[model samples]
Target: MIKLKAQDAGLSIAELTRRSVLLKPLPKRLSKITLATYRELVRIGSNINQLTRATNTAIKMGLRPPADPEQLEQLRNLLQQIGRELSQIETEITDDDDIESDGDSEDWE
Candidate 1:
């Protein structure tokens, strides 16, 4: 459990042990839904990369892609939406972090 918590906080086991002795608060993990959304984003990004590579290859070969224009526009819109979603998720996580920090660090110790 201590190792897991330390990993989540990007700390070494030694650092985590030191924090524990000092009663320092640990960083919180994202909620399950947030993690799931990130996973879905990665999956979608992989698909987009495949599509982009195919499109680029076709262009380089002087081949006109049948669904090129419309598909590219859709991908652009999707990328914008993904950016918005990421920003929203970041804001939510930042807010949560701020809430945790409202308490003084000395309180934890």
Candidate 2:
């Protein structure tokens, strides 16, 4: 008994039901990261935390940079990796949040 404009191209009740059924398991699988990537992410995060703490303590004590230039570069690369992984995590979380919110709103409608 519901009507929609042709331009809207909205789902029919049956189509909606079908789509809802298909989407039922999406939230459960959402925001999943591969185990290897997740492990790397954790390692990078730990490195960032440790480096940040050391940097902060050094700054408080007015310490100088390391004599080894390669170590500094390695730290920079690790931090960059951490940043990239965190960005990926944020995107996945946002996408999953959108999917879950859409499902909830559809329920009300």
Candidate 3:
């Protein structure tokens, strides 16, 4: 199992790929999981780009960018939430072991 320290801070695509390989026991099932997650991430990235474009368009249209301080705070909170989720996912990928071990069995009385 790869020991991914918190300092690693999952961020870039290359880092994410490296982390995926670091996972312990490297199960075949994990390959599919990783691909699926990667696809979803791509979609999320696309959405973020669209959002940025829309925000810029709004600015160009002379619209104020979230005049409410609370709205700005909420946006910040949402971004932080997304960051945490991504980090957790990267950690999970790096730390996961595929092969299931035979856990200790208990004798029923």
Tens digit of per-residue lDDT, candidate 2, span 1-109:
2333111225565664555567632222223344345677678768766766676677678896333445656776876787677666665563335533333223212
Quote the positional error of residue 59 for candidate 1 in Å: 1.4
lDDT accuracy of residue 37 in candidate 2 = 56
Best-first order by lDDT: 1, 2, 3
Best by lDDT: 1
> What's model 2's lDDT at 31?
33
The lDDT of each candidate is 0.67, 0.52, 0.49
Model 3 residue runs over 4 Å out of place are 1-30, 64-109
- What is the Å distance of residue 40 in model 1 from its true position? 1.5
lDDT of 1 at 98: 45
**Each candidate's TM vs. the true structure?**
0.55, 0.35, 0.35
Provide C-alpha RMSD values for all models, in order: 6.4, 12.2, 11.8
The TM-score obtained by model 3 is 0.35
Give the count of colliding residue pairs in each prediction: 0, 0, 0
Better of 2 and 3 by lDDT: 2
